[model samples]
Every structure is written in structure tokens, then in C-alpha cells.
Target: MKKGNTLFFKTRPRVRSYAAICGSKEKEGVIGNYADITLSDDMYGESTYEKAECKMLSGAISLAVEKGGLTDCDIDAMLSGDLLNQIISASFAARDFEFPFLGLYSACSTMSESMLLSAALVDSGFACNCVAATGSHFASAERQYRYPLELGCTRPPQSQWTVTGAGACVISDAVGKIAITSATLGRVRDWGVTDVNNMGAAMAPAAADTIMRHFKDTGTKPEDYDMIITGDLGALGSRILKDLMWEKSYDISSNHVDCGEIIYKVIEDEFQGGSGAGCSAVVMNSYVFTKMNAGLYKKVLFAATGALLSTVSSGQGESIPCISHAVELESLAAGAQ
Candidate 1:
């Protein structure tokens, strides 16, 4: 049922299985050991970076299904998105599967957005099994959103590197260890940030707004969750979000973690850190899921933030509008559901 902008899943859709596949760069990052598959080459043997992104998405979906002991025939639907125009990466990846396809475009927040829809579908009996996935490639994103990589543009200190990776989760009604309990849809918030290179600032306000709304709708506090994770707010954005929350009398400094900040070991070398459609996707599927299964984090509030800016909008000098969608995930014991 709906409570404010949050949806409470009484039936609690469980994540049956998940997979994380990343390029060599991401494979060497903090989540390196946890990813299900890591490509020795970012190209994945493909001739082009775009095709490589599609292949990564496809690989993540297939790996997730296989981990769940299922096949394409068993999946009722697939929900996916990416940073590419028209979400071509997700669309092209979907062509490799046999199930119904639902393509989404919410910038970096596509992971949580796709998972929220998948959970709702399963919880409401619209589908028995669904796969939620997304991906992004550094080279492809650079070519599309900024200058061509061939130009060797000097990245600003505030910029983040686009992660070359993909993550997928199989959500089903079947009993499982990790369950999606609720979700809070975010609102578009533009604070007049026009610097395309500084996506963290563009997205931070939305993350704070959605997280605060989720707490209000659920009658919970920041301390109620074992962790509160934001998609790709990076180091600077994460700090801004904390300050925003504190101004509202909600302090999340203790439990807050940003996927962008932790993805890399030496984050400053990559500017803030990682930022892309796959940033939160790979982190949640690899690090977060592993922690939940190990009984490390029992309750997590995951809010994936996105900057809804296109090249045309940037070119037009339009401000970047951002959004964040939050999902409440809990770790349940076997047969608890």
C-alpha cells in the first residue's frame, strides 16, 4: 500500500539471486573480490565500447538467472536501464533475452528504479519472477555526454569517472534471505547547478529529499537503518547530503555511505569517485548483498540518485534536474517470510 510517496510491500518481494560484472578498473576497486564476474578487458572482446556495455548487461542478466537456478523461460519480465541515449545499452541487451522487456531511463538511479518496479510487480502478483538490471561504460558515456575520449579532455577535479560495469538481481515471490520491504519514489529537484561536470551537486539535493521523505512516511529515523546508502553522490555530494539532513534535524552521519565514494580505493585520483548507471548497481549487487547475506547489515535504506540531464539540455544551458528513488531492504532468516 502507498504511504505518502513510499510504497510498503506487505508481501515483501525477495531477491532470489544477483550478479555483478565489471571491467578491469572496477574489478580492482573495493568491490573487486565480491563481483560475480570481472572482465579482463573492458571491451569484453567487442569491437566497440557501446557493444561492450550491452554485452556486460546481458552477461549480468544471464548470470543472475543462472545463480537463481532459472532460465530465460522462467523469467516473466526484465526491467533495465542505462546512461546511453534512449537507454540503448539496456535495449540492446534486452534483445538477447526472451522475456518481456521494460526499458527505463533515470540516469544513475536506474538500478534502484528498476528494482523498485520489479518488486512492486512481484508483490502485486503481476509477475512471478523479474530481473532488474542496468549498466554503463566509461568510454561510451564520455563520448555521449561529454567530449569524445579521443579529445583527451582534462576532467575537472569535481568530476567522477563513469564505472564500466553492470549489476542484476532476480526478484521473485519465493522465500529468500534478502527481501525488499518498501520503496520511496523521489521528486525532481534542481538547485540551478549548470556545471555538467559536477553531477554530485546536481543530484545531492534529490537524495536528501527522498531520504527524508522515506523516513517521514515510514515513521522511522536514520538510526532505524543499519545503513543508508546513496547511489552515486560521490564524496562531495555525500557530504552535502549529510549537511542537508542535519539542517532538517535528522543526522545521518553515522550510518551513511555513498556508493560513489567507496567504489574506489584512491578516490581522489578519479576525482570524487565512480559515477554512472552501474555505480550503485554493481555495489549493491556485490558488496551490499554480500554483507546482508553474511548478517553484517540487517536493514538498509538504499537511495539511488540520478541527474536527468542530456547533452542537448546541457548545450541549451538548462540546469540539471536530479532524482533519487529509495528502497528499503531487509535481511530475513530462511523461511521467515
Candidate 2:
């Protein structure tokens, strides 16, 4: 936990750029505007549940390649993961892209986890460059994990809306070196929060724990970073996390932001709280990347949190367990003036 610039000084590999690609299936939902779904109608005509994820992953990778100004062949490798059982989304995406592949699964935290691994690979001389990650969600997730949307079941205020979008990021050693400097993996935390409907409550503890650990391990304070962002802990979880941090004396209230809350713009009654895996993915790809490129912020801590629960677990009366992945990204370019 000794924090000084050791990570930077110990190794001087350059990190170039971080690019994100996003896709979604909900074309007409009230929250669709918050996402980046723009596929043709025909694409979804015969889309099976698995195909939807595959399409999203492929679209995300293509966009990342385009935005990063690199060809698929130029990519050193592709690292991806999804909510699917066998990671079909990533597998199919790899088939289309000619890069070596490494599939990952951290649930909603997959994007950050992939980025962390990709950066490490590039910095350690193992690989010159790689596309870190991507993710997707569909209406089918709810049907499989919860009740069908048609059931009209009322979601509690603490519940988060699953976002139907996919995101991809190209991480390289050549572009601008906006690399992931470090990462801290979180341990599973269950605070006796058993409301299957309220994921925010279940995930808040893990978010707080991981954020605290990141600061402790890196010897950095909240004020040291321009932004401290969390993945998808919605409104209620965000509030609880803020309180927990205060209790732990971190006091990150001012600079802290939640991807879930920010993605939906917190419109009144528009979305009960915020969104899902795609929420953090799209926000980082579209909004955060733009701001970083514009020099709006310098150092950021990206913490994506996930609720590790299933239909079977909840049905069997199991409490929701949660985890988070935190990574720090900083600008490495020299000429600011």
C-alpha cells in the first residue's frame, strides 16, 4: 500500500489511447436514448437470445477498432466477457476479429477487468497492444434472471433497470498511453441484504470496500483523482456508498459519481434509478472518453460493481452477494502546453 509513483517509475512503457464501442437492442424504450443501439431492424428480425449478445459484441469490437483507427488484424489480442453461460458473445466476436482471444467473466465488472488485464499485458512486454473489453445485455436477461417484463411486476426504488447496450474499448501502447495504471480486485461482500429486487442495496457494500482498498493500496486519496466513478450501483446504492465512505473517513462525496445515476440523467420518474452493465460501458466509451480527450479530467478511478446473484439463488432464499473491480487511468502524454 505504499503509494509513490513506483508503478509509473518502475516501468515506463507508454500507453497510447483507450477507445470504446457501444451497441444496444432496445430501440424504443424510454431509456433507449441513454444507450447507443443503432442496428438495422433486419439485424434483430431473426436474432436469437444468444445471437443478440454475439451481434452486440461484434458491433462493439468493430466500433472500437474504427474509433481507435486500427484494423482488426492490427489488434494484438481480444479480451472479452459477458453474462452468458459459455461466453458465446466473446467467442463469436473473436471469430470475426483475427486477434488472439482471452475471454473473461466478472459479470457486470467484466469491462474494467478486461481493461486492467489488457493494460497489464501491454505494459509487461507480453503484448504490444490489445483490445481490453466489451459487454452486452438484452431483454432476455430479465426473462432468464427475473420475471418477464410483461409480468408487470413492480420494481422497488432500489432496483436498477438493466441496460440493453454493449461497449468495447481498444487499449494500446501506441495511441496516447492513457493506460490503466493499476487495479484492485474486490472480495465478495454480503451484508445480509436479501432483497432480490434491490440490487443497489446488495452491491453498495462491495463498492465501498473496493474503493477503500484501492485508495489504501495505492496510497492515493479521493482528492488525488479528478473523478471517482462506480459501475452500476443506482441511486439507492450510490447514497449508501457515500455514507459508508464517510463513515470510513474517505469523504469522496464531492468528486464521486455513479455510472448508473449519471447514465439516466436522473430524470424524474423516467427511470426508477439507472441502468446495467451497458450503463457503465456506454458512459465510459461515449462520455468519459470524450471528456478525457478534451482535457477535462486527468486521473480517474473506474470502479464497476456487480451483484453476483442468480434466479436459482434468489429462489432458494439466498442473499445477494456483490463484487467490484477498480482500475486507475491517467494521461501519459507530455506536451500539455
Candidate 3:
């Protein structure tokens, strides 16, 4: 991946439409205490995470396929993943569609990883077209990770709330032709922060390490890309990442941004920082896709970061481990026109 040298692969079909499907349950302004989360009688029933993920994928995929004027059979393959065990959300969602399926898991980085793989498959002549990725979130993640919201537990500022929603995207070899061109995967890194109260502190090193490697491997300067986005490193993590980069003299302060910070506007007081996997997924579909279509930015770097620690892992006194996957997206129409 030489920088400044244009590298080309067979272009995957353009992304025609992007959509987000979220649960109707209004959990806004419900914070600080764990007891505020209402699990029962919710739209997703007992399993809020998997159910909402499936619903969001169904809704987003239906809209994308419909808007793109594609039949179910027209989809060459479905590449999907989620945070659940065995990826039940993506697997169940794929069952409702007619396309061939590939289930993937990379913890929170699943969305970007799936998108990168889909783009590779399509560009490498392995598939004609593919629906890239989707993700879901539920209150259950909290119960499994920290404490059930129903327990009224107090959360530290470093903790990020898992969102209760889903997001999806459709990628193709044609239509608008905004396709992923390249990607970089980061090795897992542990900064030795174990409290989990502040994920930014734990995940910042991984984000910085990956971002630097991406530039090194690709030989692209930070200014070359219009925007450099990270997955779920909310306010705390974003700041930590910037500081770490500066310490290494990489200084990407102007272009660096985090999806976790963008998803929810009132992030400061409400969420302490921002959200989870759904954070990057929803922001990508709802915000970045629109901007790309509008021709606001030509080249963008999306780095989705994930912390690879379970409650058990943390409980066993293991350090919080983090990983990141990055993809480059560009508009073919803009370049052609």
C-alpha cells in the first residue's frame, strides 16, 4: 500500500442507498442509573440487542434494495456481522433475505470489517455485487458487560452506553459507484487500562496506533483525506486518541473525528461521551453517506475501533484490548464528471 501512488482494483458497484432502522422505544434522557432502562414490553421484547439489530437490518436493506430498484435475487451476497454470540442478529436477518450470506464478527469493528470484505470480494471479481454491512445494539450488552440498567447502577464517565438501534448499507459495482478502494487492519493493542469506566483511555492507543500504521502503509498524509473517522471512540476516546497522535508528532487534529461523537448531538451531559457499534453504523448510513452523495468530500477514511473485552475477561484482570479496521471510500461520479 504505497502512499501518493494511485492504486486501483476492479471497482465494486456504487453504493446506491444507505438507511438506518432504529427501535421506537424512547430511551432518551434516561441516564446515570441502570434502573432507567426498560427491557420488558419493549418493541424488541426480552432480547433487545439481537431483535433490534434484525429489525434495523430488515428495514435498511428493504429500503436500499427498493430504492435501488433491485429484486431480492439481484443481491449477489449479504455480508453482515454483529456483537452477539454466533452473530445471531446478522444470521437471522440474512435468513429473511434471498441473497447468499456470510456471517462475520469483529466485536465493534464488525461493520467496517464486513464492508471492507464485501468491497474486496466485489472488486476482486468474486461477486458482482454485495450488501455491505449492518449492526445492532441493546440494553442487554450493559447487563452482560457491566450491570443491568434495571439494577440502577451508577456509571463512570469513561463508560459508553450501548445504543438500542441498527444500521445497514448496500454496496454495488454500479449505480452511484462510490465504493471502498482500500483498507488496513490493525493488530490488537492493550494500554493496560482495566477499569472500563473510560473506554477512550483504553481504546485510544489502539486507534492512534492503527491510524499511524494506515498512513505509514498507504503513504497517505492525514491532509490527503477529507475526513478521518473512528468507530466508537466517543468524546473521551477521541480526545485521548488526538493527544496520543500529537505525542507521536502526527498531528491529525483537523481531520480526525469519531462517529460516536457525531451520532448523538447532546453528547456532553447525556452520554458522558457517546455510543457503541451502532454509533458508527448509524452515523455512516445517516450522515456520511448523505455528505458523500452531496459531493462535500471526495476521499474519506473510516476507522472503526473495538474493545475486545468481555465481562469475564475484565473480571479475570485482563487488560482492555482494542482493535481497529479502516476503509477508504471515494465517489466515482465526482471523479468521472
Tell me the number of clashing residue pairs for each predicted model: 0, 5, 15
Model 1 RMSD vs true structure? 1.6
List of clashing residue pairs for candidate 1:
none
Error of 3 at 181 (Å): 1.8
Which candidate, 1 or 3, has the higher TM-score?
1
Runs of candidate 3 with Cα error greater than 4 angstroms are: 1-13, 23-49, 333-337
- Among these predictions, the greatest lDDT belongs to 1
What residue pairs clash in candidate 2, if any at all? 15-177, 16-175, 16-176, 16-177, 17-176
How well does each candidate superpose onto the true structure, as a TM-score? Answer: 0.98, 0.87, 0.87
Poorest 10 consecutive residues of model 2 by lDDT? Answer: 1-10
Pick the winner on TM-score between candidates 1 and 2.
1
The TM-score that candidate 2 achieves is: 0.87
Give me the runs in candidate 1 sitting further than 4 Å from their true place: 334-337
* Local accuracy by lDDT, each model: 0.93, 0.71, 0.70
Candidate 2 residue-wise lDDT, 1-337, digit = tens:
2242123312433334333333333334333443344554423544575677677767777767776677877888888887766777788878887789998877777777787777777777777767766666656566667776689766655567676567777777656546567777778899988887678778889989988988887889999998998988877888899999999999988998887776654445524455556667767766676566666678889999887777788888989888888878775544321
* Tens digit per residue, CA lDDT, model 3, 89-135: 78888878889999877777777877777776777777766776666
Shift of residue 30 alpha carbon in model 3, Å: 19
The better candidate by lDDT, 1 or 2, is 1
Kindly give the stretch of ten consecutive residues in candidate 3 with the minimal lDDT sum: 29-38
Off by over 4 Å in 2: 1-46, 266-272, 333-337
Q: Comparing 1 and 3 by lDDT, which wins?
A: 1
